[model samples]
Target chain A: MIEFKNVSKVYPNGVKALNNINLFIDKGEFLVIIGLSGAGKSTLLRLINQLIPVSTGQVIVDGVRMDTASGKILRNMRRKIGMIFQSFNIVKRMSVLSNVLSGRVGYHPTWRNVLGIYPEDDKQIAYKALQRVDILEKVHNRASDLSGGQQQRVAIARALAQQPLIMLADEPVASLDPITTVQVMDFLKEICASDGITTVANLHHVDLAWKYATRVVGVRAGEIVYDQRPSQTTKNQFIKDMEIVYGRPIHHDEFVIEEAVV
Target chain B: MSDRIIVPPPKRLGQTLGILTVILVIVASAIFARFNIIEVILGLQRGGRILARMFPLPGWFGPLMETLQMAVTGTFWGALLAFPIAILSARNIVDVPWIRVPLRFFLNILRTIPAMVFAAMFVAIFGIGNFSGVIALVIFSFGLVAKLLFESIEAIDEGQVEALRSLGADTLTVIRYAVLPQILPQYISYTLYAFEINVRSAAVLGYVGAGGIGQLFERALAWRRFHEVGELVIVSFVVVLFLDFFSAKVRRSLI
Candidate 1:
């Protein structure tokens, strides 16, 4: 379980990225945080992993309080939380298998990892993760050689290789085409469902949130304005709630046309 | 649109001509002081006679081989030493300002001294041989290679580095997996570039009794054997050209 108690983030220049927000994410839940650009969706997701440290309040992950965690404890905490970035973040010059193998570095000694001497079991795990993403065929290819969608799949495989307790994705599909976006989202959804890993994703498209998220949380101006289960959400009510989050009425044209078709 | 608003072409042309006149005057003054066309014309006849004497080259193939050997050894050791220095100087890999700053300053100081001066100093201290020449080239190559490699390191995508860090990889692992792979080709290319420079510098290192074909040239000149000196110069040119061709081929394959 991930628990946020009065979490707030104030930047050095004094722009509040997140307000004193309290929330709880149950284990195995597929949660999607939605907002406009710069609405703190990314910040909230990053705070869970302590990627961007919280300026105030406590974030307790599993049993460790991240705000106070330091040195080895902090690293240990990060090892269990796998993060996926919008840009894929795979090292372009490295092979796909090596990029996936990197996710296991935390488990090995520093010298071992530096020499890239992962155990046979670790290699098997990496291969398994690639299989899960259906990108096993590209295992020996350089990350840059793959197309954007393939690279994103490789990124997913890398995260899965971590065997993380919690998966954090920050706008993972924002740069992908529509078909690839849906495919990537389905892969993420499947990973969460099958592995029972708690997944938190920051999404820009409202329809995608409704389609895949079990629970949806809305943020506006650094504050959570709405949080609800997808089944209980009415389309009109969701749009009405978005007014506070967006500071304006949600336009019909902004909704994904494919979601309407479905 | 108004007739009164029409600009005079002659006035604009005069302004341009005035600027051109000033530039021409400066060029003329610089050429007169530095080049002196009349003196160059007067000296050409004497140069022709010297050139006539330099024809029909004598073979000093043995000294030529010695020069090539010196350059190869110096560049080999210099490039080898540059590897660790370059890695330590990378900002992402070496976080401590105390270490990074001092190492960077040391590299800067190494580069600031010309290679010939380094050879001269080593000759004075170690008393003249290929050893001094090799040491000079090593220091020179280290400065060039490390500077280029560190700058390339700084320009790498920080995203990959962050990804490794998030995976809980230690500093060394991050460098190996994230930093090294991206910069390796560029590093090799830079080392080769440094090698090309070292070859030329090594040729001249023998001027200070650092031992190479340059010693032969110096000896021949002292004895007024311009023919032998001319042969050595021709041999040096051929060797340098051959090395340049090989270096270019290697660099082409690396990138």
Candidate 2:
């Protein structure tokens, strides 16, 4: 379980990126945080791994307070939490398999990893992760050579190799086209379900969040405005609640009518 | 779109002040040294007489070949030692402050000392041979190559390093697979650049009794054999130019 108790973040420049956030995410939950740009969705996701530290309160993951964790304890905590970036962040020069294998670095000693002397079992784990994402065939190909969608899948494979208990995706599909977006989102949802990993994703598209998310958390100006399950959410009420997050009424042009119709 | 805009040109106060300070210092130094343009003109007449004595060339292939050998040996040793030092000095590769800071400071100190001084120091220790020249060139090249390479390393796309870090690859693996391939071309270019510089510096190492073409020039001049000195100068100049051109071509291709 991941719990946020009055967790807040004030940047060095004094921008309040997160404001008194109190939330709990259970295992195997597909939670999507949605808001307009600068609403602290990314900041909130980063705080769970302490990629950005919180200014106040505590973030507890599996009963360990992240704010107080340091050195080895911090690294151990990070090992169990996988992060996916919108840019994929795969080393372009490395082969797809090597990129995936890198997710296993925290598990080995520094010297072994430095020498690329990963054990056979680690290689097996990497291959299995690639297989899970159905990109095992491109394992030997350079990451830059892959298509955008394929590269995103490779990134997912890398995250899976970590055997993470929690996965945090910061706008994972923002850079992808609509078709690829669904494909990537479906993969994320599937992995979350199959692996029983609690998944937190920051999404821009309201329809995409509604389709893939079991629960939606809306943020506005660094504050959580609404938190609701999809089953309990109505289209009109969702749009109405989104105003507090977007600071304006949901524009008709912004909605993908085909998805809403479906 | 402007509504009665009052635009003032950017102030030139800094540039004007800098130029004025430079002029003032130069004027003050010239006055203190009793500057005389007439003295320089008279010295040129004496230079004409010295130039007249260097007409006939002496045939000495042995000394010429020895100089070439010295330059080649010095350049090779210098470039060889620079490789690891350059890699260690790169900020992205060596994150430890204890290692990086000291290595950077040492490289700076090496660069601050002139190649001539290094040659003189080595000649004092090793005693009048190509060995001293080669050691000087090696140290000199290490300073030059390491500075260029570490700067190149610092400028590399850090995204690649971060990606490697995420994979859990050790620092060395990241450097070998990600960092090394990208910087290899530039590294070779820097080595060639260092070699070019070393060849020029090595020729003069013999002035301090470290063997090279400069030794032949020194011997001929001491004995008042202007013809032999002229021959050594011409040959060394041609060799330096040839090496410079060849290294430039190679660097152009590598980069």
Candidate 3:
């Protein structure tokens, strides 16, 4: 579980990315954050791990205060949190297995990692992670050689290899095609759900959010504007309520309706 | 539209002034250096006669081999030392401006001093031999390779590093997993490039008594053995050409 108390973030050039805010994410919940670009959605997700420091608040993740933690404590806290990016940020030149094994770096000493000596159990973990994402065949292939969707799957496997308690996805499928987007989102949701891992994903597609998220939160101008459970609201009502989040009527293109079946 | 004719645009005053400055500098420098077409034409015939006498190459594999050895050794040691320094100098890797700025300045100073000058200084300290030349080449290769490598490091995709950090990878682990893999090919390519340059400079470091075939070259010239000088030039040319071709092939394969 993660909690943000009176959290605010201002960039060095004085852009207030997040205003005085509060948010809490419970364990094993697939929470989707919906917002326009630059609406502090990313800032909020990153704050949970203290990737970006909070200006004036406490970020407590599973009990430890992330903003004040340093050195071994910070690293120990971070090891339990995995993050993925829209760009599929696996090392392109490295093999898929190596990229996945990078997830275990936090568990070992620097010299052991440098020499690439992972334990036999760690190797099994990496392989199982790859298998979970259905990318086991490409384990020996270079990461760059994979297609966009496969690359994203490899990134997911990398995160899973960490055996993380929480996974943060920043626009995880923003670069994938429609069908691939659904496939990737399905894998992410299914794996995290089965593992009882908390997942916070930033999604541009409203319909996808409706389909996957247990709870959906909307952000605007560095503030949370809407929060809902799709189970409690009708699909039509959810679409209608999103107008307050977008500051305008929801466009048909924002729904991702055509890709729903896939 | 078909009947319309476009006129040439007039040049801006600044452009005209820049061109004029270039021409002025060229003419002034040529005059100061006493540029004489007739004298150059006359000198060419003398140069041709000397070239003709220098034909029928002499055997001197020992010094040529020594020259190559110096380049190989120097480049190896220089690139070895450059790795850590380059990591420290990269802006993305080391965010502290105080550390990075001074490291950059030190590398700049290293590069500013020519290999020949470094050879001269080392020769003064260590005495004349291939040791001094190797030291010179080491310093030179370090500057060139480190500068090129750090720039490449700074330009790599930051997202990969971010991913590593989010997984709780320490700085060294991040570098080994994320930073090094992305930059390895370019780093090796740069080191090979430095080796190529070192070969040429190593052959000439003997002018400052730094050692290698350059000392032999100086001896040949001093003794008026033009044919041996010609032989050295031809051999050095062949070796340099082979290395350039081989290293280029290797570098291409890396990418």
Candidate 4:
């Protein structure tokens, strides 16, 4: 379980990125955070892994106090949390297998990873991760040669290789086309459910959030405005209610019509 | 549309004045330095005779070959030294301001001094030999490679580094798995480019008694062996040309 108690994050420049945030995330729950461009959604995701430190209160992950973890403790904490980015941050020049194996860097000695020497089991784990993501055929190909959608799959495989308990995806599908977006999001949702890993994703698309989220948490100007499941309100009412979170009405195009998705 | 049209382009007075001032300074300096156009014409006429004597060469191959050797050896060692220093000096990689600052300061000083000056200084300390020449070239190219390479290192896509860090990889592991792979091609390209430059500079280092073909050039000049001097120049020119061609191809392939 991940719990945030009165978490307030203030940047060095004094921007209140998160304001008195109180939340709890259970294992195997797929939570999607929705907000405007500067609504502090990404900050909230980064804070979980201590990528961004909370200014006040505490972040306790799986019964360990993450805010105070240092050195080995901090690294060990980071190892169990897999995060993917909007840009699909796989090293372009490396073979897809190597990029996936890089996710295993925390488990091995520095010399072994540096020299590209890995135990057979780690290679097997990487291959399996790729296989799970359905990109095993591209394992030996350079990451750069893959298309954006394929590359994002490679990034997912890398994160899976970590065997993480929590997966944080910060706008994972923002850069992808609509079709690729649906495919990647589906893959992510299926993997999280099967592995029983809690996932927190920041998504600007209301329809995607509504479709994929088991529960949706709304953040606006760095504070939680609405937190509920899809069943709490009908799709139409929730769409109208999202105005308070966005400070404006949702556009017609923004609505994820069931037909478009189907 | 009228409101948009009302806005005028920025004035060119400052730019025009700046261009005019640069031209004025160049002209003034040329006049102040005697602007000897006639002397240059007459000097080229004399230079033609010297070029003419260089054909049907005699005993010029040995020292010319030695000079080529010095550049190759020096560039090899210098490039090796440059790799770590380049990594350390890149501000993006080394978070500590103290380390990058002092290292850049030293690199600046090294770069400011020419390769020939290094050869001269080393010759005074090590005496006339290929050792001094090679050492001088090493220091010279080390600075060149480090300066060029650190900038490329800094320009690398930092997203890969952050990804490695997110995976719980430490600093050195981040460099090996993340930074090195991205910058390796650029680093090799810079080293090859430095070698191309070093070969040309190495041919001149013999004037300072730092060894190689420069010593032969100096000896032939002293004895008025104009033909021999011509031979050395041709050999040196061809060797430099060949090295430039070879290294350029290597750099192109590397990048």
Candidate 5:
């Protein structure tokens, strides 16, 4: 479980990224955040992992205060919170197996990790993670040799190797094709659902957010404008409310509509 | 329709002033240095006579090999030492100004001391040997490789570093997994470049009695043995050319 208590973030250059954000995320919930670029969605997600320190308020994750956490305590806390990025962030020159194995670096001694000597158990975990993401066949291949979609899957595998209690995704599918987007989102949803992982993702697609999110939270200008579940609101009502979140009517391109294959 | 032609763009006052300033600086420098065209012509004629005397190239096998050995040994140790120094100096790797800034300043100071000067100093201390020559090349190569490597490290994809940190990877672990892979090719290329430069400098290091073909050159020139000096030049030139070509090919494949 995660809790943001009156959380607010202001950059050094006087940009207010988040304002008085109070949100609670429960375990096993696929929570999707939707907003335009620079809407504080990224700042909010990064606060949970302590990548970006909050300007004010407390972010408590599983009873530890992320804002004030330091040294080993912070690292130990971070190891349990897995994150994936829009660019996939996998080392291109390295093998997929190596990239996945890097996820387990926090569990081992620094010297062992530096020498690239992962335990047999860690190797098993890495292989299983790659298997889960259906990239086990390309384990030995250089990550740069893979397509964008495959690279993202490898990144997911890398995060999965952590066996995390929580998963954070920052625009995970912004660079993928429509079909690959659905495929990747499906894998993410299914894995998180089965594993009972707390998932917080920032999505660009309005329709995908509706389809996948157990709870959808809409943000606008550093404020949470809408939060609802499908069972609590009709699809038409959700679309209508999204207008305020986007500050305009949702455009057609905001949704991923898969084209018919020839 | 009027027949209008495109005209050449007029030069701005700043551009014109800059060109004039450059020309004025060159002229002033030439005058200050007392550059003489007649003296240069006379020097060229003397150079041709020296060239005529340097014929039937003497055996240069031993000293050439010694020069190459120094380059190889120096580059190996220097580049190895450069790895840590570069990592410490890189802005992305070591964020603290106290550590990064001072390390960079030290590297700058090291680079400012030419290899020849380093050789001369080492020769004075170590008493004129290949050991001194090797030490000079090592220090020179370390400075060059570290400077280039730190720059490369700073320019790496920061997102990978962020990803590593988010996964709770320690600083060293982050460097190993994220930073090292990205820059390994560039690192190797830089080492090869340093080695190529070291080979040339190693040949000259013997001039300061630091051991190599340069010592042979000095001895031959002092004894008025122009043919032996010519042989050394020819051999060193061929070896340097071959090394540059080979290293360039290897460097190209790496990146």
Candidate 6:
């Protein structure tokens, strides 16, 4: 289990991004955090991986106190938790295979990875991950030559090749078209189900959250306001509950038209 | 749609004043330096008379070859040394201010010392020869290529670096994967650009007893052999022009 105990984060400029957040996530749960822009959803998700250092309180991950860990220990924890960004930050100058193989760098010696001496087994793993994401044919292609959707798939394959225990996606589909959005979301959902990986995603569209989330946690002004299963949530609740989060009622366009019937 | 934004014209007060000041300074400096157009015109006339004897450039093989050899050797080693210097100087790659600060300060100090000054120093240390010229050119190239390359590194897409970090990459691995690939082409182009410039600089390095075409030119001038000096100038000009063309083409392909 992942636990955040009275965790708080305040920026150097005194802007509080998270406040006294105590939460628990089970091993195989698919949790989606939804909030308005800068509503602390990203902060809360990042806290799990210790990407953003906690200003106060303790963050215990699988019984290790991550807040006090340093150097290699922290990096070891981070390697097991795969994170993807909105921009699909793949190195454009590299081939797709090299990009995926980069995910395995943490597993080897520093000098080995620096020299780009990937063992045959790692290459096999990278290939299998690419195949899983259905982008194996583009393995030799430069990342810059790929389409937006294809790039995200490549990002996903890179994360998968890490063999991470948990997956965190920060608005993975915000840049993608509607058709490709569904396709990428389906792949993530399928991966979470098959691997039983604890998945946490920050989603913008309300309908997308409702479709994918086993549990939805709403954050507003650095605090969790709504935490419930989708069966217990309604359209009116999405507005009334998120009004404090968004500083207004949720708009219509924020919901995808083709909402999945889960 | 109807409410069009009216853009105001740029206020040129500063620019106008700046141009006026520049012109005023130039005129004042020229006058202060005893500006004499008649003397300059007479000098140009004498230069033309000297230039008329330079047809069919002389066989400048000996000194010309020395200059080329010095530039090539200096540039090869200088370009090689610049890689590590650039990596250490780049702010994104080396976050420690102490390391980067000292490296940048040293590079600035090296660059501030002109190539002629370096050649003189090398001549003092190693005595008059092509070795001193090569040393001077090597120092010049190292400073220049490192400065340009680090700036390119700083301007690269930093998101790739962060991505490598997310993969638990070490500092060296991050540099190899993220920073190297993005900046390699630009670094190579800059090195070639430096080589093109080095050839021109090497020609004058012989002035300080650093050995090159300048030594031959110096000897020819000492003897008042205007025709021989003219021949040397023509040959040097042709070689520099050809190197510039070839390097320009190569740099274009690199970028």
Give me the candidate number with maximum lDDT: 5
- Candidate 2 CAPRI-style tier: incorrect
Candidate 2 residue lDDT tens string, A1-262: 8999999899999888988999999888999999989989988987888867889999999999988887667777877888888888777767787788878877877777667677767778887788778877787787899988898899888889899999888898888887788788889889889989999999998877777888999998898898998878786787777887787888657854355443
Runs in model 1 lying further than 4 Å from the true structure: A260-262, B1-66, B69-73, B80-90
User: Per-residue alpha-carbon lDDT of model 4 for A111-152, expressed as tens digits?
Assistant: 888898987677778878888789888877889999999999
Model number with the top DockQ:
3
- List the candidates ranked by DockQ, beginning with the highest: 3, 5, 1, 4, 6, 2
Which runs in model 5 stand beyond 4 Å of their true positions? A258-262, B1-59
Candidate 4 lDDT at B48 equals: 80
When sorted by TM-score, best at the front, the candidate numbers are: 3, 5, 4, 6, 1, 2
Which digits, one per residue and each the tens of the lDDT, describe model 1 over residues B11-94?
Answer: 457889999999999989978879676787779978878886887434566656666677778777777787677778877666
TM-score of each: 0.83, 0.75, 0.87, 0.86, 0.87, 0.84
- Candidate 1, DockQ score (0 to 1): 0.24
Structure candidate 1, residue pairs in collision: none
lDDT of 5 by residue, B1-255 (tens): 132322223346669989999999998998899998789899999998888688643456678888999999999999999999899898887788898888889999999999999999988898889999999999999999999999999999999999999999889999999999999999999999999999999989989999988988999999999987787788888889999999999999998
Q: Is candidate 1 or candidate 4 better by DockQ?
A: 1
Give me the candidate number with maximum TM-score.
3
Model 6, residue A211: distance off in Å is 0.9
- Expressed as tens digits, the lDDT of each residue in B165-197 for candidate 6 is 777777888888999999999988988888888
Regions of model 2 farther than 4 Å from truth: A255-262, B1-113, B125-127, B156-185, B211-217, B220-255
Worst 10 residues of 6 chain B by lDDT: B1-10
Q: Give lDDT tens digits, candidate 3, residues A1-262.
A: 9988998999999999998788888999999999999999999998988878889989999999999998889988998998889999999999898999999998999999899999878878888888889988787788999999999999999999899999999999999898899899999999999999999999988888989999999999999999999999998899889888888878677655474472
Candidate 5 docks at the CAPRI level of: acceptable
Task: Report the C-alpha displacement of residue A255, candidate 1, in angstroms.
Answer: 3.6
What is the Cα-based lDDT of residue A249 in candidate 3?
A: 79
The CA lDDT of each predicted structure is: 0.84, 0.80, 0.90, 0.88, 0.90, 0.86
**Model 1: native contacts recovered, as a fraction:** 0.64
